[model samples]
Target: MDFWILAIRIIFLVQNTTGIPGNFSLLFYYLIVYQKECILKPTDLILMHQMAANTLIILSAGVPQTMAVWGLKQFLNHLECELILSIQRFGRSMSICTTCLLSIFQAMTISSRKFCWKDHIVKAVKYIGCYISLIWVLYILINFIFCVYALIKMDNKNVTRDFGYCSIIENDKIIEILYAALVMCPEFFFSVLIAWSSGFMIVILYRHKQRVQHTMSTHGSSRNSPEFRATQNILALMSTFLAFYTLSSISRGCIALLYNHSWWLMIVNQFISLSFPSFGPFVLMNHYSNISGHILVWIRNKIHFILF
Candidate 1:
């Protein structure tokens, strides 16, 4: 009924409407349509995993947060809350991990030609599936512990902290600190990796640009190379992720530490958390012109059919 609540609901509605379909379209293209034309690369696999995780985040966290803001009360029971939050955590964790991995992979890919460790990088690419599966398993176990703790804690009547649509158990100071460390430490480490890789990419691109300027004949070919283009895209992706993730983390930390559950801050935090998942697919689509072309053709065909 309030103006801010109405605006927040509209924001969430737009985010969910765009984010879900964008992620699914990317996922479908990568999983099914990609291999038909060209050999699927390790980067493609990582992007697929990241998109899948983004979809999970939007569905589990974004949808529930939207419902909560729309005046839904106690829509989720304790068990459901645990399950949804666990899935959301898992998705968020995997999204961070995959982004880090993607940056590292692109850096390696661009540098492998000049380094003596080219074979090693090739071998690592061969086992990318194993790496992704291991990451999935690790996050699943960690979030399973989180779910179990929430379930056990929910049984205690005195410690429950209620959000509008869902609830979680409040823990003691020690447990709270431990959980915070558990979540933040790994994210910080991954953030560092992403920064390092992004820096590496920028250096490479800068050097390449210098070389291109000195030799105009090969400029177009070098600039059009797959490695160069992918490095650029990964750098863009990392920038977007860090920008949104930092804002989301700061807002969440403020909420947790200050116990300031103001409506505006909560809405801001939710919007920041959903920002990447909502817009990241378009970033990738821009890099892969073929995907954008397909989307355009699909839209034109539909319009033509309607006109006829």
Candidate 2:
């Protein structure tokens, strides 16, 4: 194996084990394990469903690559390749849909009290489950031809190869332009939504922080309630998650554009690819105080129990 190929495998392995599933698990633990006493809200369910989708995204990409790279398994033929390619295509399609749902959900949640949508949030949220599922099926269908093409004869090493993940055929400049358009369009939209939602989150938290500081400095009552504190923390966490996603994607895009087959450049790209998934859990842990504390204590206690 080439050194860079070997390095890329190592990078992706770490990413698969931790970055991808860890984030989903964090959210899973919060929704199913920790917060079971509370009735699950529609938004919570939607977000958790999205988390599930995110987890699937990692599995679809990582499993095939891991198997291929480690030589633990082999496709041996195009039939197996089709299955893997289809799965990855589905995962990515679902991720795009979920992201849109997340942004719209956030928008609904943040609507003005007097807005027409405010009253609809509760009722409409109840239907997100069905809607998201519908979108998943639709996405699968849309990507069917694309995935099948991977299993077909293609000169593009990126999409059809031993690499487990395939790339688009660079030979087709028209398709390349289309691919770039597809990537940049969604990225641009998501960037805007993330920025818009983050602006709200930051402003709210900033004002709350000012209020707290004023209360402390001027001897006012510490009126910041537990719920408010928790809410603020969640907002901060969401903001960080968006920021990490944005930066990682930007880095990936730049590298793709600038990649010149240099070892060092390849290493840097491998590192970013490896590190991308880890950001999700990091953002979550940084934002949610209760969950973060619980997980830390849980891990420490587990370690101590094992040792003693």
Candidate 3:
């Protein structure tokens, strides 16, 4: 195997191995283990949904791509190809929407009582499940457009363009651009929403920090506070999502524009695109106090049992 191809396989192996299990563990912890401890909060529900989505997303796109990289040609049939891509895209969009909702919900929770939407926002959490269901249906409809264009053709030796295991044969630039726009429009909107909500939370946190500092200069007290930690987690979540999303978008755009598409570039683009989904669960889980604490206690008990 070529060095680059070997590298791609290693990357995919590590990513799917780690990401799939990590997401499943998170989903199970939140849905089952954590429930044994306390009632599921809206934030926990959102994160659980995101974990499930990320797992499916990785399995749909990452698995097939990996198989193809190892020289398995036409890894998917026409119907399977279209279905996988549609599901992957749908999962990705749902992840974005849920992240945006999470940020906005956190902001509302931390904002001053005087804030205009305080009461309304408080009520919104009660209907989070309904909202999540609506988002799932909406994205499924939005991505059904993929089924129209996605086709499985025998891997042609002469063809150099590598969109995916499947192919889209669009000769017209206008139609291609329109198709791209239709696919990306929802993601762009959700990205903007995440940014806005994150920004609002930052302002609120900054003001709160200033007041806390004025009262007491000790860093430990302020940093260890539940509210402060929640803010940190939200900021980290937003940063990771935006950073990976932007990099992936740019790389994908370059792939579209380049006449001679470099396979390495596409592989790199796939890695970047998969970054947030694959790693996002770990990020939130690390910062979530209750979950992390429970994990630690469980680990210590396991160690104790083994040693004794």
| Winning model by TM-score | 1
Model 3, range 6-105, lDDT digits (tens) per residue?
8888888788888898788787677656657676788878888888888878998888777777777675665676688678878888878888888888
- Model 2, runs deviating above 4 Å: 1-11, 20-24, 27-39, 64-76, 96-100, 107-117, 149-184, 215-219, 223-237, 251-276, 285-308
- The lDDT for every candidate, in the order shown, is 0.84, 0.58, 0.76
Which residue pairs does candidate 2 place in steric collision?
158-166, 158-167, 159-166, 159-167
Residue 241 shift from truth in candidate 3, angstroms: 0.5
Candidate 3 regions exceeding 4 Å error are 37-39, 148-168, 171-182, 218-224, 289-308
lDDT leader: 1
RMSD (Å) of each candidate, 1 decimal: 3.5, 5.8, 4.5
For candidate 3, the clash count comes to: 0
lDDT of 1 by residue, 1-308 (tens): 58867888899999999999999988877755564656578988899999999999999989988888778878998789889878988999999999999999888889887877688788888899899999999889888987786666665646665666787777667556666677779988998999899998899999997887777765545444777987888888899999999999999888887664776776788799999999999898888879866656666876999999
Q: Ten-residue segment with the worst summed lDDT in candidate 1?
A: 217-226
Superposed Cα deviation of residue 53, candidate 3 (Å): 1.6
List the lowest-lDDT window of 10 residues for candidate 3: 151-160
Query: TM-score for all predictions?
Result: 0.89, 0.67, 0.83
Query: For candidate 1, what is the TM-score?
Result: 0.89
